[model samples]
Target: MVPRPTSLLAWLLSTLAAIVLIGAGLPGPAAAAATTTGVKFVDIPGDGVTLKANVVAPAAAGSYPAVVFPSSWGLNDVEYIAQATSMAAAGYVVVSYTPRGWWASGGEIDTAGPADMADLSKVLDWTLANTPADPARLGTAGVSYGAGISLLGAAFDKRIRAVAMLSGWTDLNYSLYSDQTRHLQSAGLLGLAAQLVGHPSAELTTMLGDFTANRNIATVMEWAKVRSPATYLDRINANAPAVMIANAWGDTFFPPNQLADFYGKLTTPKRLELRPGDHAIAELTGILGLPNDVWTSVRGWFDRYLKSDANGTQPGKVYLKPDNAAAETWSSWGAQTTSTKRYGLGAIRWYDGTGLLGGSPTTGWSKSLPNDLDTVANGGVVLLTNGISAFTGLRPTIWLPFVDRNRAGVWAAERPSTALKVRGIPKVHLNLTGTAANGSLVAYLYDLDSLGNAALLTHAPATWLSGTAGSRTLDVSLSAVNYDVPAGHSLTLVVDTVDPLYYDANSAGTITVAGGSYLDLPVK
Candidate 1:
């Protein structure tokens, strides 16, 4: 979690004083490099509160376009200083504000609730009234927490004509309670960060408590639905804002699967881009006025919609960057895959306690493992593991010989004759039987080299609460990703009961896996 400020008043005063000095042309190197003229800090009226904000516009601006940026979680109004300055120099009035309950802003943190939506409209009101901004040309953009607010703002306010959401989630339920299991680490990190920097609303506090305790799950799901933008997709389509979504494939907080599903349902002009990095890492440099592909695409998106510049924007295209491969473009998300490959699971072998993966379908053999154990095949640490992989291009790896077959079920495939380009979601189906009434299983897809080293490609988890007496079929869809498997490398599958990334229900039982199981791979 992030550390708290020494004193809220002192921190706020220091930040505002720096902005004032920058406006006066007497600040540090970074501040001096920004657009100096027409920069001012002000307090905008919110929903019965005051919002600390700043405005940057062209010095000789007539009626230029306008953009509003809401700060991310645990950040203040100065979060977008560099991008705001560059947009101001590009003939656009930019207003960046601290959301309520963070830094100097008033009111409790609503967590992108109704109050946050209203606050966004108020920021737009202040922008049109104070700056020389055209009312007809309006846009909103943000990252992570701010990204969710921006998407919801477009649905509430028809004045917003364009939107760019980076590292944001559309389905809150899918993010927190995907496949009927709790995403423990991601939710825990978010709760801690909010408590450190801001005051959570009564509803948010109650929901977090219930979520962690695994009590009143119904109430938790209902509360999350209200905050999810997917619940208001119809309203967004009716308002018809040109939307652009950019996200990283390895984002631990907000995965790309939900965003891809949401992108498929949009009727308005939209674009989707999935790159290789962790949450917000792909756009971090761009926030510093540095050259970045994601930020460049965002600028092009705004130019096309807000300023009607169609020089670089593709309205209905999907862009993807696979690991160790060139970027690819398609007409739509569904067009990325040309075919699907199905593999069968063979009986567990005695040589190395591993089974065949791609032979004919073999049945009548059952393998049982202790349910309350974890194996080496698991998702890495929440933020640090994937964040480091973003720069190193090395994913979490495991050795086949080290995996305890008594705790996990492992399967291996023969070396492929040619390279395989995986472009979409992979799925696994299993016939499971447990001694207790409930259990959980995590399925991992890996790329195995000749030396028995396996690199994790994608994975998913499933939990069952009833009908443990008989065999039950569980279908799980792994995360969406793009990767290339080189020739002579094999594909492997691993099923375990526990992963540190999620909360499992397995305890004091043996989960049995029968035959007639299969895996489906989507290839381009």
Candidate 2:
């Protein structure tokens, strides 16, 4: 069973307290030159609130291209001090501010809702009026919450010319409720963080209440739609801001799949970079003014669009960096895949309780597994697992031999003669018959070595809760990834009922998997 809000909150607080040392020596706004010759912190009037902000302008500045950065969730104006200083030193007028109700800022937290969007416009207005900021060459950039607001600002405020949305979500609905399953850990962490460091509005409070209780979901999605940039894609395209999106493949809060979809629909000059990391991990070093690829590309993006520089990252390209491999670029998202192969799932062998995954299907068989129980195959703990993987170039691993077959259905393919460069999203098709009215499945794709050690490549979840029991056909697209399976390595698939990362809808029953299920692989 999923933990109640109180239990989740307690867990979150304890986890944060234990990991607080991770941030002990990190730079803060005090370490930044807030009162430097060309830098100053000030208070600006928001729509109906007061915003704490810092402005960094070129010391020998005429009017210059300006970039406004709204602080990330649970952060204040100093969140972007290093990035702002670097951008300012490079001849851009940069203003970074805390959004309403975060830290020293007044008003309740808007969660990047309408009021937050209004604050962004107000910050821009203040920038142009008070500093040597050129109104015509305006741009916005941020990470996480700031990134979402920046993207929405580009759609609502036409004066913005370019945007770099790092680790941002294009669709809020998908983030909170993907595959009709609540992302319990991610949502709980966000809600708890807001309550710890900021004031939550009534709307945000109610949204969390309905979200956790699994009630009024349609209304919650409606509210989310209004904040999603995907909902305003037409307006964004019409305004034509050069949009550059950089996200980690393992971003729990704002996954890369939605960013890829949003990037595909963009008619304006756009770039997408998918790397191996969790939410904001890929760009965290850049926040400390260290050398980072995402921030480098961010500066390059603004230079090209706002300053009309000739030497910037070329638009209309997608960059994918695989773990422990060289970065690869493509003309577009579609070009990431050359062809796809469908692997039919066969009957489970009685001796090992495992099935064969091959080119041809084997029907007339069924396998039953107890629901509401997790196996060795599960998505790792939300942030820490993926963040460690990003830095160490390793994924959460499992010994395939130890997997509990009674709790999960396992399938393995034959070893290929050559390496398989898996590039795009993997699709799973399954026919599930559940004894209970509600059930869920977490599907995992793994690369298994000769010794039976398996590394997670990608995974996704699907849930059925329409008060209908019996058979249901589920088509699930696993998270997009770029992984290479070495020659002589086999691909493994595992389907289990519960993962701690998501809310499990499964109850006390057995879910039977029918034969005719298959997995689709997109390989380059």
Candidate 3:
């Protein structure tokens, strides 16, 4: 059974003991939005130093359902107080806390280590002891770092009645380092955010060093495992808090695949809102006084479980918003699968390829352009343009710019007699012979119109180590997406040597794709 405070007088005394940390110069946790009248900063004595948190309770509250929000990496309570006040207005007590080693907090940052998870438990205990937090109706929520921590905390503490995770990763290894390749762009930006906010912890500094130097990841491999919630699925499943995941469809940082894997492993009550945007845009917009799915779905989740007032909102439903397709909903995850359609890869020319879709197996082959192996500026630039720049803001009020691939090694299928809807990730198989010590290849899927204009649907990257002319077969999984193929349009696969988002060998190599290679798309 979950635990609760039985004595009100003792809890009040603890609340009165709240203190301002000396030399830290931290301000009290007060709500910027005036929706909640009773807002105050409270300090809870923790393992090493005091953990700082802000409490926002209903004005005339006797006992109210409570929700706690942990800051995203390098952020403090200030980042989430706006949402806390909104919860307070809905008659819920909210505790927004800064994790250890962040601004105005104590102890070195552990980045979701045991110390960080322990900080969550401390906030829970303090909430129950000092506020009118409903012992039976408590839940936790956050985005990114805090989102993963909520799952980690729920795994150990059964008291979390419900959970809402936004743009979080289920597997740390896959999200941070996929196929032993680092996601340099996202990780570097996140590390920059950490540095801008506070001094770096030893662990974080080590990770940055290894990534920038392109060193083997063995130095910090074990640390990454412990932080991943996928490492503790058994514990999370046993606790079984009702889960609602609200994430973007185009979030390259924590793509839909990671969320899909975690969602599939659970048997608990659940809901999914797969919107369209990059990593932080949709989520931050919602947090900072804007209307979006993250806050809406989370509040409904808390209402259903913590308040026991669901108002007929259904769980287990999948909400999806495709880029060019109509919005759709699935009854449940089990009902959301699409049929696998195989399309053959055929050589349009010696250096270019076009998709031979809906046809039987062929005995033809396609070879990549040696020109791509050249470092000189050429058509390769068009194939490798990712459309993301350093100036892009974290809070996006619009969709990410579309990728442009005009001159590329493309395998494309012309408009079919019938229309189809792509409902999931696209898989690619490559039977190729290459001559290079080491190399990496990237595959991007696009939906093209009769005019040859196209929008990028999904993309994937792979690294290979070979010396002589050696043959290898690669099965690659592109990004997870939902797109509609209009009757007059076409589906395409663009192959290239490098991407701005990841590290590439940039060395010379000639690759010949054999006849058996194909692109398999999940369509309906």
Candidate 4:
């Protein structure tokens, strides 16, 4: 159980001030306002540093609820003002500040560390002491790195009443190392750039060197072991409510499962909202706009908690937006609804003589010599005017290539009529036997539409079953998706020797894949 801030001494301080101010003939600010007026620049005192912040409040104000938006990436106070303004217009005082040393702030910007956390605490103290904000209603919200800071701050400070974390990571170690193993190619560079342009700290510089040399994974992992929030879950107070939003279709960085794991550990009254979108700041801004279902839910949550609206706030709100169903679509999981579905790899059958897999082998289809390990190359001839060729555009939509001793084989699945709707985790159960010493199997999930277009859903880790083995199941889970398999479209299951995005194949091995192997999909 987590301690409630309302029972803390700080809550008493705010309550006493409210009483004294009322007795002195001063009234609190009005709650209904179209725009915020008073804007003040303030300095927050930190350990050996000062943090700069922009405060927005109503003109006529003695006390009002406050929301804080922490700095993210390299964005400064000016860029955060628009988001702050919107919250301010909703009758809440808004404070957007540059975290640590990002811009015009003292001390170093260490992602989530003692210095950064202390600075955040100082910011809260300054806001409570200097602003007309009702200390009892303090809240924080942000996306990505900013969201990470807010979560960490709220974990330590009881004064923070509520929180909204968007696409944030609870374990940096898992996110940077385990989940995205090839970080040197992506997030590693971005982090290096941030250090070069912002902090210029020696530790950051050394870390950059380690990353560049490929020797930094160990050091980075050590750092993550110390700073990861997953290790500090018990420290998070459960009294304050939280809302976590994750993008199901995000590919830039951070896997959806990582977010799910974080959400599962939160003991607070929490709602997990998963959407389908890229890691675009615009999509987040759209969420803030409350233009549609996405934003509506978020605003409603804040209204109930921050404003203490009379309308009771419902719990356990889960929204899953399906892919390609509509221009913009979503599925809701509320108190009164329950739904579940499954998508799997259709069964495997013999390839007919005519390039079709059926009762007989396809004509002109010859199993070529063993290419690299665990793979076999097969060629087939089909009439150009055949319905199969016409419908498939003369190419296989689903390609499954396996890895064996020194060869690999490409296997393709037939297309479906309607677009397949994939909602949850899709697992591929492959039964393969190696002819050589040892080999590995890789599976890919994709969407093939009616227009002959193919897009990747998510990539899975390569599973090395056995080299001198009999038979084993290669299970790989694709990233969760709400994507629609279009009407007259087909879903694809590709098993290849390599995932170009993750790894390269060393030796293609000769392997036999049983046709009965099935794909188990969890759909909802």
Given candidate 3, what's the lDDT at residue 441?
67
RMSD of each: 4.7, 2.6, 9.9, 12.9
Best by lDDT: 2
Candidate 3 scores a C-alpha RMSD against the true structure in Å of 9.9
Off by over 4 Å in 2: 4-36
Order candidates by lDDT, high to low: 2, 1, 3, 4
Q: For candidate 1, what is the lDDT?
A: 0.83
| TM-score of candidate 2 to 2 decimals | 0.95
Candidate 1 regions off by >4 Å?
Answer: 1-39, 467-469
Please, what is the whole-model Cα lDDT of each candidate in the order they appear?
A: 0.83, 0.86, 0.68, 0.53
Say which prediction, candidate 1 or candidate 3, comes out ahead on TM-score.
1
lDDT per residue for candidate 1 within 8-37, as digits (tens), equals 424433443354324433222343335435
lDDT of 4 at 323: 44
Give the Å shift of residue 41 in candidate 2: 1.0
Q: What is the TM-score of each candidate against the true structure?
A: 0.93, 0.95, 0.84, 0.71
- Ten-residue stretch with the least lDDT total in model 4: 377-386
Give the worst 10-residue stretch by lDDT in candidate 3.
375-384
- Candidate ranking under TM-score, highest first, comes to 2, 1, 3, 4
Q: Which stretches of candidate 3 lie over 4 Å from their true place?
A: 1-35, 350-358, 369-407, 435-437, 465-469
Candidate 4 Cα lDDT to native: 0.53
Q: Which window of 10 residues has the lowest lDDT sum in candidate 1?
A: 1-10
